[model samples]
Target chain A: MDRQRFDYLLEAYGADFARWPDGEREAAAAFAAAHAAELTEVLQAARALDAALGTRRVEAPTPDLLSARILAAHKRQRGAGLDWRAAAALAACAVFGVALGYGGGLLAPVADDGDYFASAFETPFADYDGDEG
Target chain B: MIDPDADLVRSAGAGDAQAASALVRRHLPRMVALGRRMLNDAAEAEDVAQEVFLRVWREAPRWKPGAAKFETWMHRVALNLCYDRLRRRREKSDPDAGLYVADGAASAGDAWLARQRVAKVGAALAQLPERQRSAIELVHFQELTNIAAAETLEISVEALESLLARGRRALKAALADVAQDLIGDADGVPRV
Candidate 1:
């Protein structure tokens, strides 16, 4: 990295090499070390700004209530999805049951009430006569 | 690119409470931090974080990881929410919109000074243009890789660097005094 490029990156990313672009970090570090005597002033300025920016601390303490609320929302959505799926499954089962009953009825032999009564009468008197004998 | 959060996101998407909770635990703080930096309001920051997660849950089941990582997408959503809120603040033109309110409880000398310094730095950050502020926040505070941060902003890495440079320059100028104080404090000089 040339002086111009190094200074540009330094100003942009501050003194922390970790913050520098991945492709240029090693080259920039080498340049800095090689010209430490000359780059001290610029590097110090960048570090100073970094430290100043660091003072603006943000404490991100996640409130339990917020977490619970988010999780609850997720559960609620999932629950609704499950409810829909369950309803669909029940409907499908009902439809299948109806179809099976209809299909079985169609496939079964039809019984004649007339034939049943005739056969019953045909056997009724014979059994009675035999008992009497 | 292999996303580290892919497994978690998939499990969470499939209604795994443990996975969802883990996702929340891992990303909630960073989301909150980004919002806090952008909006400079704790309550609103929490709102942004919650909103981001809400979107996450909504999209999780259908979330197809494509170009961006899940974390990067979350950051983009959070940033857009922040930008929307910022735009609304501008439309309403609230005088106290970006003001950094120091804690009234910090009465101790050192604590008060530190709070003052924080307030100053925050105000300076607040003054930056939205893109510039976002660039600095992502690179400096969020510590996102350049590629990730650039994707979050929907900008090229070169443009991201430009924004960072401009943002840092403005901040450097604005926070010069605070920088001096910090440097002084670091050098063993007593903070007055």
Candidate 2:
């Protein structure tokens, strides 16, 4: 790994370098002897990186997170349909309330005209209870 | 509600409330993973992932299939979200989550031996740049093809290669020591 060749390898492979070709093995070995100093620096730096990253561990997604995710999936499955049902239910309730209120208002004239009807009946111009029985 | 991915996407696009939640769940993991890799923090990753999924789910009706894979699209959505996160998110969080290797006492067994070697490799992998980390995870670790990985990063093949090369170089530098430690004298394998 001469300075020039080493630089080329470093450039060619960098941190993402792959295993050398089988044919390149003999050549690399020969070069290694000629430039052991450069090889050591590059190789050691690479090793330290590997060691550091190797020791940093991560567990699989936690059981709680998995369960939570699944639960969320289920909730989503249940939720979209519910929105429409809720809106429909709300609309029905609104219509029902509106109709009820309108009908109540319509009956107000009847309630308010009771005195007028009673006066007319008492004057003998109309019958309040035509069939008293 | 229905299968969030399909049902909500269909119904919610047609304007349904319940569909939204289903969509959220369906897309959450990728969002989280994207965020995890981008921000390198679970809590922050969750937040960013949630945001991405929510934004995409809102537009699910407009989602056209055949143009892209669902997972790929989700990844794109996430990477973009993570880009934003990377811009503003602090780097104070833990490093073990993003691109990392396993750690523990290698017990006296073959499995331990394999783990010891693999761990060294993983540690070496961790020292890579985020783009390199992403590429390696996409290519080597996750087994995604170059094209697929490229799509996820929205980069061309050549660009992906560039990222991969740098990543590999970093790994080579990092792992050389472990290789030396394991290999015996004259860079030979150590005696068992």
Candidate 3:
């Protein structure tokens, strides 16, 4: 690896060679062996960083309350308002909507309001006038 | 290679109680750690971890393993939860601002000094922009591989590295005095 690429990896992954990307590990090691002086500087900086940052121990104990709460939430979801029957009913409605959208025209075309009006009006003014007379 | 959690996830999805419990136990600590670092509150972190597992339990049956590692997905969920809480905090103008600072009043000796450094680091971390803090948290603290961390943040590996570099620089700048105290002697040499 070149100096620039090696520096980038050093900044990104710190001095721990194992943390470097697997593909670049061999090249990185080779470069480190060749450039011991620069590697030493980087390692020193990374070690200081590790020391400073690692001081605070972050512990995440599995509290019984948290575990119980999580399990209870899961169980509640499983048994809650949206059971299989409700899911099936929702699915059936969706299927009905899709079927209507695709095949409704084949069963019956919607009549035109203008055509119905025109046919009724054309039924003869004469008949209407005679009846009025 | 198949992820070790693939089978557990499948069983969990199939409503297997033991498998679900195993998955929770396996992933909760890291998820909580991630949330704590991101949110800076242990109680809230625990809540976020619970929500993440709740989501896992609901979505497990439909989990497609080959697309990504289950742990990566879990990290994503926890990150999302943390982000949500952060947004809410911002909306409220940080009513709980003091929650981020750990109690450091009662310590003595090296323990006190070490705590000061940790508190400074944590404070500096909290001061960074959200994405940079997340990048540092995922890589430095969560110990996710760069590729996995990138996937968790939904960014490229290159972008993730860029964020890390910037975050590290900012951290070094913010913790300059603390770093000096911890490692720098009067002559810039390390203390024995």
Candidate 4:
């Protein structure tokens, strides 16, 4: 058989591939049925291998162990997160303190009248009164 | 299949506890099986599997989703673990280069040709090179597509075919002895 056809047949008969598309699988199977004899010996060999490598499933770690490990790592991570959050919070507080001390009017103006008096004191009328007095 | 909550992968990568357990639970069995087959020693395989997952957890932060599949990458990681375990097995001078047992599997299973009748098959397998063994294992046992299996081995598909052909021919010749054992009373049975 031609290499291309044979390759198709191999795919059809199946190799130890983890997954394959359906249409391709069907095509391969058809090719193999037609060329059974020519492919027999090799197919048998492959089959034997397939049989020998069985899926002997093993045990996973128990939940407690899993949880302990997870929690341990979680705790460590939590601690790390706390540290980061603390650092960020401290930085934010420091910035706020600086703004309050030096930025002036750290809070929005609560009284509307304060600015009016301050502006009025600087006006020409106030200057004239102060000079006359 | 991936963990539904890949958040575990992220947290575990960054050293989260519950995430670590979840990651372990999600991956341990498959990894163990891979390790078991690769190293052929259950304990050793378990250790390798543990190490593989640990590395995966460590690598979670660097995972590039589109570059390649996360599972394919994991398979590659498992393959590397297997290779490392193979080397470690050889270093200690264990017999058969650490190939796993020829567990009896049904011929009907995945259309597997039964090894129950072919004792020489296992021996021949043990005698084959590790590359050949991996090629066989992935294709026959794991049932991976040629291209995918090749990727797992970091080899080209043509190279995989070459290895398989060579391996098959060797198996046929090696298993010839079992011909007698299989057809003890061949009088009625059709002859080739």
Candidate 5:
């Protein structure tokens, strides 16, 4: 990296090579080593700024209540999801039952209604007449 | 990209309690940290974290590992939520909004001094423009890679670097005195 790029990165990322772009960390470190005397002031200034900024301690401990609340929401969501799925499954079963009934009726053998009715009467009448005779 | 959170997200989506808890364990603190930095209020930061996770639960079922990782998406969501809150505060124009309240029970000595220093740094950070502050927060504080930070901010890498530089420059000027104090105390002990 050139002086201008190195300076630019140093300004942006500070003295921590870890914060620098991965590809340029080696080059930036090498440049700093090669030009330590010239870059000392700027590096020190960046370090100071880094140190100053570091003073703001962000202590964000996740409270148990918050975690419980979030997980409870997830549970509620999962419950709602389960209810929807169950409803869909029940509706599917109803549809399948109706379809099965209709299909079975359609597939049943047809019969001659008049002949059947007459045969029913004839058999009973014949039995009565034979008994009377 | 190999998303570390992909499996957890998928399992959580399918109602895996362990996975859901694991996801929360991994990301809740960071989300809270981001919100704390952006909003400067612990309660509000917690609210933001809750809101972000609620959105996560909603989207988890449909979360597709796309261009961004889950964590990156989460940071974006947290930031947007913070932005929304910030905008509302601006609209309300509350004079006391976003001010850090010192704990009454804080004991004296180094603890109090450290709290003061923290407040000073926070105040200096508050002076920066939102984008610049966000750039510094993401890269420096969150320790996100430059590429990831740029993606989180939805800006080009070059633009992200520019923002970082500008932010750092402004912070250097603002926190000069504090920096000196922090660099070396009266006893010449480095107190970073």
Candidate 6:
């Protein structure tokens, strides 16, 4: 890599070779080896920033409580999801039961052919009783 | 992509409790670190990390691989959470309020000096425009690959490089006085 590309790589990845893009790293490293003096100055400047950036250390979450909380939350969410699925399955079963019952009734021999039309009209009790008398 | 966590992620998505725990344990530290660096508040960072894990739990079952690496997705979620807090901070900005306190107890010695330097660098970083600061944090501090960081930021690699260049230049300028302290030699060579 030329100085321009090398500088760009330095800016993009700081002074860390491992952080640099894979393909150009060899070229960049070779250039650094070739132009040791110039590269050292640039590398130093980048490293200073990297060093300063490194100083801010964030404490990891306390192992016991944090992990427990995370897993508990996971379980709670999964449980809720399961609950919904269970409810859905129950509803589906209910619908299927009603459908199956209806279909079975339809498939069975007709108790009365007039049964279908029987519910279509409502007759006063007096008319039925008078006709029977 | 060959995600190291792909197996754990798949197991977690299948509702394996142990797998879920493993995934949480695996990714939580980096998420917390990213949150802390982006937000500069330990408690808030923890909250962000928790929120990220919570999302993971909810989405894991529906998680479809080949879309993106799980850790990359986690970073995106964590960054988004940080951005939300940051926006809230801006809205509630108070001139009287200090953005950051001294990092720790100050005492005479190199330790205190080191803390001071870190604080100075932090303050400079905080002063940068949010995008520039984020670019620097993701690539430099978080050690995300340029491509991954760009994906996290929803920007092109070239744009990310531009931001890095600008961010680093700004950082150097901001810490110009401390440059000598950073590297002892005027030629920018480290004494070590």
Q: Considering every candidate listed, which one attains the maximal TM-score?
A: 1
What is candidate 6's lDDT per residue for B75-106, written digit by digit as tens?
88988888889888852222112123334564
Those runs of model 4 whose alpha carbons end farther than 4 Å from true positions after fitting are A1-4, A7-24, A35-42, A55-133, B1-26, B89-126, B171-192
Q: Per-prediction TM-score of chain B? A: 0.90, 0.62, 0.84, 0.64, 0.88, 0.84
Candidate 4, residue A21: lDDT: 40
Candidates' chain A TM-scores: 0.69, 0.36, 0.55, 0.45, 0.66, 0.61
Ranking by DockQ: 5, 1, 6, 3, 2, 4
Which pairs clash in model 3?
B13-B61
Error of 4 at B16 (Å): 8.1
The iRMS of the candidates, in order, is 2.5, 7.0, 3.0, 6.1, 2.5, 3.4
> Which tens-of-lDDT digit does each residue in B39-85 have in candidate 3?
76778888898889888988887899888898888888888888889
Give per-residue CA lDDT, model 6, range A1-133, as digits (tens). Answer: 7888898879867887888877887887888899998677788888877766665655544446777888999888778878999999999999999999999999988757587567555555435655554
**Candidate 3 segments whose C-alpha is farther than 4 A from its true place:** A79-133, B90-107, B184-192
Any residue pairs clashing in model 5, and if so which? none
Stretches > 4 Å off in candidate 6: A59-63, A88-133, B91-108, B185-192
Candidate 1, which CAPRI tier?
A: acceptable
TM-score, predicted candidate 2 vs. hidden true structure: 0.53
Question: How would you encode candidate 5's per-residue C-alpha lDDT over A27-83 as one tens digit per residue?
Answer: 999999999999998988898898877766465457999999999989998999999
Worst 10 residues of 4 chain B by lDDT: B110-119
Question: lDDT (CA) for every model shown?
Answer: 0.87, 0.57, 0.76, 0.58, 0.85, 0.77
lDDT of 3 at A54: 56
TM-score of every candidate relative to the true structure: 0.84, 0.53, 0.74, 0.58, 0.81, 0.77
Poorest stretch of ten by lDDT in candidate 6 chain B: B91-100
Residue B114 accuracy (lDDT) in model 3: 56
As a whole number from 0 to 100, the lDDT of residue A66 in candidate 1 is 89
What residue runs in model 1 are displaced by over 4 Å at the alpha carbon?
A96-133, B90-107
Cα lDDT of model 2 by residue, B1-192, tens digit: 122255456665565656655555555655555455445577777766656555554566676655656566666666666666666754543443443333345455744555555545544554566678777556553445566678888899668867866876766666665555544433555644
Sliding window of 10 residues with minimal summed lDDT for model 3 chain A: A51-60
Q: In model 3 chain B, where is the ten-residue run with the lowest total lDDT?
A: B91-100
